[model samples]
Target: MNSTTDDTYAIAIVGGVYRERCMRPAWQEVYGSAGRAASAMASMGVSVELYTYYDSITEPVLISRAAIEGFKFSGESIPKSIIFDYDHGLATPRIYSFGSRQSSLRVQAEQVLRFGMLEGSATVHGKRVVYDPQSPAKPEPFRQNGSTADELALILNYREARLLSGGVSTSADLIAKSLVLDGHAQVVVIKCGPLGALVHDGKSTDLVPAYRSRSVWKIGSGDNFAAHFALRWMEEGKSAAESADLASRATAYYCQSKGFAIPEIFESFTPEAIVPSEAFRNGRRPVVYLAGPFFTLAQLWIVEQARKDLTDMGLEVFSPYHDVGCGSAEDVVMLDLAGIERADIIFAIGDGMDSGTIYEIGYARAKVKPVIVYCENESQENKKMMQGSSCLMCDDYVSAIYHAVWTACSL
Candidate 1:
């Protein structure tokens, strides 16, 4: 029986890589791509899972109701039938093929070794230095160790056995056919970057155009595209043509916005607005809310510096993590503390800022609080979130505080 009886359906992605030589970049690309797809799928209400047979530990963290099960690359637990999470309407039981099934830890280890390629060797400004090859450098015309035996064999065997034999015709063509013939999937899309995507079913093939963008990091874009398309397909439940079209539109919208790269989606957190009279008894000073994800080491330094900057500027600052005791609530909450509620201005750090911080921004703004939003990049999504409602956009925390303090004083 078809499992999608409810309003939503679960999708399992059983794709991953475990290359030995090109481990780091390979797995990084794979996980990064997959993570984007997973996030996109989540956005569209599809229960999604990625079962990668690699040892890399860079997979996306699943902290909410949705679960991403990571087994050892070759673990037996992964071979079971795909199933969706019934309670959450998440894709539970879908398995997408990646490579030879392997254990997760071993795959992770192999990924690390690939990452070690960064230390192999390189030339900088005429000085021959073994530059870290593992770092996501500009795509080179040729890959290192391209002539290795295993890679050669894998390629040769795949071409000879899979391509030459009666495996459809082209790899992508075969993949399109397999979506229907083997997986019983109704839609299949293969993205070709600038060339766009080629979508197909058993009967027909459609070529979709790629959206043009000014270039904000090109990492994980394909994953984002896939997830968007899959979820859209599930939601629309229309023809394959319509689903692919919606997928194309969604990818274009995401590419033009920041939700694909940075994780904060402010629309989801738009707090209930408060009347001017209900303002806190203690008058408003400016308070900045930091919410999104946890802080990275470098981001931590920036946050610390921002705190110092705000303190020097004589603005009252409240970081939920640093100042208030907050739990993992879905929406932001405003503490009944003295200075928080009456703040004249609100500041929020959007990138990976915890949920509490984000809530504070919404809470303050809902009360018509003047808000300043600072992010590392000038992402369109962040810009839109902070738009019109007394929010200022900033590149780094330093300028963010500066803008917030200035705006508050001017107000």
Candidate 2:
């Protein structure tokens, strides 16, 4: 444990390190939460110390080590090691852990960071700690020995706050109050995804909007938000609102780049740079809306494949089947219409007689939106409609998506 002087600015990340397998865009292995945050902070000229378990005997641990080594921060400081072996599999927002150990380590620094339950029951006391309850499914309870009232707790969404309060309250004030009442934290931050985040400092709560990004690969966005907020609040002496705003910008940058390095423009970013209208607005890029029948397994799988292919082509996508699940009938209609309205182009799979998808195509055409229809087996009536509406019809899915991208860019 290192004692901090009044002017010392150092950060210590105490969590479990693992390898992430991204299914979107492509299947590739990358660094998990802890490693990503450490590298992100280090790239911003902050000295970071990582406390995690790593053993060469375990293949996952070895992979995690290799991933960390590939980052620029691997040579910044000597990482402390713990002797627990575990395999962490990250499937987007969800983490699958096997052989995870639950042991505590004494982390000494001005600020301490913890993400999920996989970090174990490490007791952090008498320090400015920042904790993120990673998932609502498996929430991490706060446990500590000594008393310190200056801590920040970050939640993925408002629903996850129930795990901390043991009650059913979604209000940011109530959640923050519940955490403070339970002696869990003094400050609480709830990340509302595209809607931005809410920060409560036990006195007042503020809502911070997320910045607009050109592309969004939402795997490690929360980790980047926590890392930036901790550094700005603890080291830079920024207010909670200011810290949350900066963190949102940093997260937007991460989501757009989907890389480890932070952009130099974010060093002096301002609130004026944010879109201010919507959190997930498109930035100088074409937005493609995917409309198809997602009722069956095969249909849903095809839609997902098309989404990934379009995403890889550097275009923003609005997949109603993936984004809007089997909700209420009214809710589904409203959500899908909003997505369609924001899109510059619509991609429809017209192979089968899907009434909902056909209606979507009609609505998009009515709005003067370009339509790209793909149907291997189409009827005469369907072909007549496709030709009448000036849609590019193709029998192949790949060719249809490529044509959609080209058509969208040309528009």
Candidate 3:
């Protein structure tokens, strides 16, 4: 008899429960995918059971938190992660992971209980399955061909989908459809950072937009989406698109509150839908103008990282330092101005209030290019003119990058 048939729990979440520590914006809490998802569903009034491995020292703490999350948990004592997430929320965190299941151990679904790289025909026998292959940036799971469930909803982040699809597809829609078209899943969802998600049900493919929340901490957001989707699509039997939209909304709530205490009436919440830049609709990506002073090592690091990060995120970036290396004032100014003219938006580092950066900000403003300034240690008086000019001044580094990308694209 499959344990899934019992009403003791609405869904079983099989994953890790790490002692997570995130910085940059300064967050001091601990939750792995399993704990985060279980907590999310439980808060939404769904009966959730978590099965996983945990550190013996934190077993008592896990039990106490599980009780508060309104879920039951059972797992073996094993070395777990003390993850330290950095300033880059979207990137992989530094994890001290411990598990000796080195050689891949195959497991038959037998009725759904999971996490780890244990890949096989492991979804529930007859139940609708919502599976997310990657957990925060855990080890890549061993690939096995073909999967089956009463209904399958396979969710993967951008990198995982690209890797799974062999990095051949140009777009998320293509990647998701390829997975479905091939037999990896009946329904596939590729999570694109700001562009939202691309969902492909064997028959049709669609782009579901991510909702805008006041604050965005991307650590366990994917886990929240997986949980919400599992509830709406698997338990309640909602349409794939509708379930994804609802899940996106719920994820926004998680980002907004930075916790898993989702309300039962979360559906009633309406968040602003992220609108991609008009150029994106036409398949043209907006160019980002990187404007900042790189006088010292720290300054140079930000400039370099911002350019690399933006470029890796699939944006056409024009960095003055990299593009126009050490040069005379005349040629550099001429080329820099031209680059700004070619760009749709600008990201300016206002730290130290460098004259050149301030000049670029003013130039961007005059050119009507959308500007996002990252200024952490500036006085309000110095920001008066920039603020009056309607520049989007952000104090946070990661947030500024995100703002620049989204702002540029939407322009």
The best candidate by lDDT is 3
* Overall lDDT per candidate, in order of appearance: 0.40, 0.66, 0.74
Report the C-alpha lDDT of model 3 over 1-411, residue by residue, as the tens digit: 123334577677766676766667777665777778888888888887776556766688779988776888775555554455565675556756454542222223323423433311122343466677764344243234223465567788887888777776877888888877776677787888678888888888778998877666777888889888888887777878888988999988887777764564575678889898766766677899899888899899889889887887768999999898767898799899999999988888898989988999999899887898889899999999999999998887766777777776677
Q: Residue 312 in model 3: shift from native, Å?
A: 2.0
lDDT of 1 by residue, 109-138 (tens): 101111111112111110100111112223
Top candidate when judged by TM-score against the true structure:
3
Q: lDDT of candidate 3 vs native?
A: 0.74
Worst 10 residues of 3 by lDDT: 102-111
lDDT of 3 at 48: 74
Return the candidate ranking by TM-score, descending: 3, 2, 1
Ranking by lDDT: 3, 2, 1
Better of 2 and 3 by TM-score: 3
- Candidate 3 to truth, TM: 0.88
Residue range 1-411, candidate 2, lDDT tens digits? 322222243776655555555433443443456666777887777767665554343335435643554322221111332332222111223444545454555555567776664535445543677777676675766564342325655544666776667764756567767777666776777775434677887778888876655445666677888888887877677877888888888876776677654447676544323322332333346799999998888898778878887886657999886788878888799999999999999999898869999999999999999999978788778679877988778665544765676566555
**Which pairs clash inside model 3?**
14-114, 277-409, 277-410
Badly placed stretches (over 4 Å) of model 1 are 1-9, 17-31, 49-60, 64-195, 261-411
TM-score of each: 0.32, 0.63, 0.88
